[model samples]
Target: MVKITNKEAICIAVLFLLGSNIVIGSGMDVQNDNWIAGIFGFAYFVPFAFMYARIQALHGGKDLPEIANHLFGRVFGFIITAVYTWYSLHVGALVLRNFGEFVKITTLTETPLLVIMLSFSVIIIAAARLGIEVMGRLSTYALPLVVLILVFMEAMSVSQMNFDFVKPVFVHGFQKIARAGFSAFTFPFGESVIFLGILYSLKKRESAYRIYMTGMVISGIILVTLTLMNIFILGPVEGDFYFPSHSSFSRIRLGDFLQRMEGTISVSYAITCFIKASVCLFVACKGIASVFGLSDYRFITIQTGLIMTYLAFILYKNTVEMENWVINVYKYYAIPFQIVIPLLIWIRAEFKNRKGKRPKKSEELEINGGEQEEAGNEF
Candidate 1:
């Protein structure tokens, strides 16, 4: 029900697309499988980006749940909506956990993990409670700082770059590299599927394709460039170390006065993570509202945030356990819900169109006209 301008929608998409997931997830993928993972990751977005654009074009300013309801019936529609709602919360929790681990390991080693989580939950809940407009505005303001930190990190580390490190890039077997690519693509890029919920709020639906695809392309380029840079500076061996990008920043030295700038990346990542979490929280609420027929969407934020916090706590026993979950559970659980369900809805919409037998609410009302008239007469 909240109206947003095209520019605001684009900004939100960018925040959703290039959040802590890319920063932390990319590094995690690279650490797991070297630079090959980045390559596969980029490829994963190709179809995902197209699927999103196609679904938006077909629906024309409707969320996925609405589209599902149109093509399917209310029963199935509610089911799909519930699945998406769960998916969004699960993703929110996963990203929160990832960020919590990153901060605890890198910057705030002494801070209790629960304290960090509660702090993050408070910020995310606050932003979500302010509504989508504020979240979009915050992203517009924060994106520049995040980009600047990335640029500065890349610039300062330029001298340390060694192309030879990424050389023999396919030194790993093609099959292994391809598998890594599958993992990368699924984690950061395919996850963009969640943004479909907000596409209807854009002032210009036609521009959704251009804005989203462009954002993904830009995000992919950045991720690939960062992966290459990490490999160049840290070598393949060191790139495998946890938080390679942070480590790369730690090595920066600008005439001895501009040192220890690694925290700059951390600051940027924190802001990006906040925006990402906010967007996920908003989408989760929207999906729930659509499912339960809630008149006010903002009311669900606290309850959902609490649920998300508890889910994050239960998601992983530790960082290593979380990483294993990301590799195994996430791909299996997320892919079907994120990719398959939307694809089915889109296909059903088209097929129903071909049959010229799509159901409409007006038709349903007309069919029940006698009962309505009798009830009105009784009243």
Candidate 2:
């Protein structure tokens, strides 16, 4: 099996977290306190991150579907695996649509969304054909550049930023803060659950916890920074814009030289979203292959990518529905797949592993006793 180091895994996870987040607000409902909401969200995801990492660490070096099937029976495993694959496929489509929308709305107004998605799909399919190791390498190179762009953009826009915009903090009260935390957790942060499929290919199984924790911490910091920047630049109306970061950056004006710097945000989104989409497709294809007993998943990569492109085109009527669904429904909708299944799997893995190890421990004790008795007799 192809193996990726924990470093590469962390890179992939960071980019994945930042992908849709660059264009989407984390806690838009709370307006100026979005960064606080982001903090709460990260805190909420920490324990589950450990759970996810521990499960992957325990069952490392195997594909997720294979692990599931072994832990559960073939039929039940197939069912759970299918659930995860579908989540990846559907989210990949959502990521694709987000990319298309950003490009279409921000740059190519006349260009067709389908064409834009198709173009992005071509690259994702290429990455899939190349393999996970290549994907990791690409992420390693791309993440630094993408992050640098974010820093540069934030720096450039700093001159125009108004610190008072985020004033009157926490006026929304604890319930609202907690609600925003829940929303943020379910999205960009909690979605880390999907990394189990990717983490199984890690070079060092023990690094799974480090990868998840480090990835989330890095991405969480970047996200909180971006969230604060958006609120600082856009004020209470920050939540009004569908793409808050882009909107805030677009307002930058450096004596007409570097005006409308939002293009850099587009470039950033394209790079990270591409990585996210590639990972999703990789996980989905791999799961499908494991289920059907296929020898390789690369055979279906192109077909799956194209299907994702098509779904991207049809998933929502416009950005308004996308926003509504994201803010209103997505958090609750994702609970079963993101929270319930992973929790069940982790609990089962702990139980089965402990129960399965008891026999080995007892057997070892018996063998040691026999060896000691033999030594006593000889002496």
Candidate 3:
């Protein structure tokens, strides 16, 4: 039934949390203090992760759609599920578009972005069709390789890093750093809501708490380290670069031998991106299947992939537009699904639990009466 071990789940979660942030460089706008922003972002998201885990625990491995149905009833639950379904599909498309944009900017200048997106969609479709178990296993194996490459590259570039660049914390004041942290918190960290779709697939439902906390911490550390590396390597000019982590790696040179390790960075990016996209696609397919009462989610994977690929093309007209949306609009757009809806669900769950635990009026009256035969005893 598409079950996966906690380790596999962690792998998927970490990779999904890592996502394009490794390439996009989270909180880059804060420049030298981006690490601080990363810390704040991670801090802000931890509680939400905890809350999500609590929901999972309360529901006994039921996914979001099922939980919604149980908590909200048919009509409202279907509506909520529909919104979640759209969010999953929408986020998946945006991530695919991010990949397409990255390729078009860095590698395939001569090729059309649409073609690249479509090509990537094929792989994502296949992965989603294979089910969450296969994806989880793939993630378990691939995450380490990606992390190793990242650490190796970071180590090699260490010689070039200047610690001084990261100094003078809050030079632009705490406001800017806080804003960047808020932005960072929303895009990738808060996006963990999508995991609600697959949390039910865990072999041990209780592992949800460990999985969420561990995954978020690992990804947050990676993002923070990457941000620090960008500051150390690129310094003040880090803000000028779109993908600071990638740009930093490109600058790596050792003597007359080692140089230009963009390929390594590219491979790592592709691996993480593929894992993220696959998870999102799987979530979308599974959510849809649940909403429609389909027997299998695999039936809709390819069709959903096709639709997302097309949507990716129309998502943004240019890089500037995309960046503007990401920096300015996405955080607000994501709040409803990531924070608001989840908060509502948590509240409802709590209220229902309290209601169930409260004694009925008859029971309360009987207890208050304290022995109905007190009159006979007195006589």
Candidate that scores best on TM-score: 2
lDDT of 3 by residue, 134-183 (tens): 98899988999988998999999999899999889888688888888888
> In the order shown, what is each candidate's alpha-carbon RMSD?
7.5, 2.0, 2.2
Task: List the candidates' TM-scores in order.
Answer: 0.88, 0.95, 0.94
Q: On residues 277-342, what C-alpha lDDT tens digit does candidate 1 reach at each position? A: 887888898888888899877888999998888888788788778767766566666678657876
- What number of backbone clashes does candidate 1 have, counting pairs of residues 3 or more apart or in separate chains? 2
Error of 2 at 50 (Å): 0.4
The lDDT of each candidate is: 0.76, 0.88, 0.87
Tens-digit lDDT track for model 2 on 1-379?
A: 7898878888999999987998787635988888899999999999989988888888978667977997998999999999999898888998999888888998899999898999989999999788889989998999999889998988888888999998898989988898889988988877777787888788888899998889999999999999999888888888899899989888999896779888888888889899989988988898888878889999999888888888889999999988987899989989998889989999999999999877687799999999999999999
Indicate the TM-score of model 1: 0.88
Ranking by TM-score: 2, 3, 1
- Which residue segments of model 3 deviate by more than 4 Å? 359-379
Candidate 1: segments with Cα more than 4 A from true spot = 27-36, 356-379
How many clashes does the backbone of model 2 have?
0
Clashing residue pairs for model 2? none
Q: Which TM-score value belongs to model 3? A: 0.94
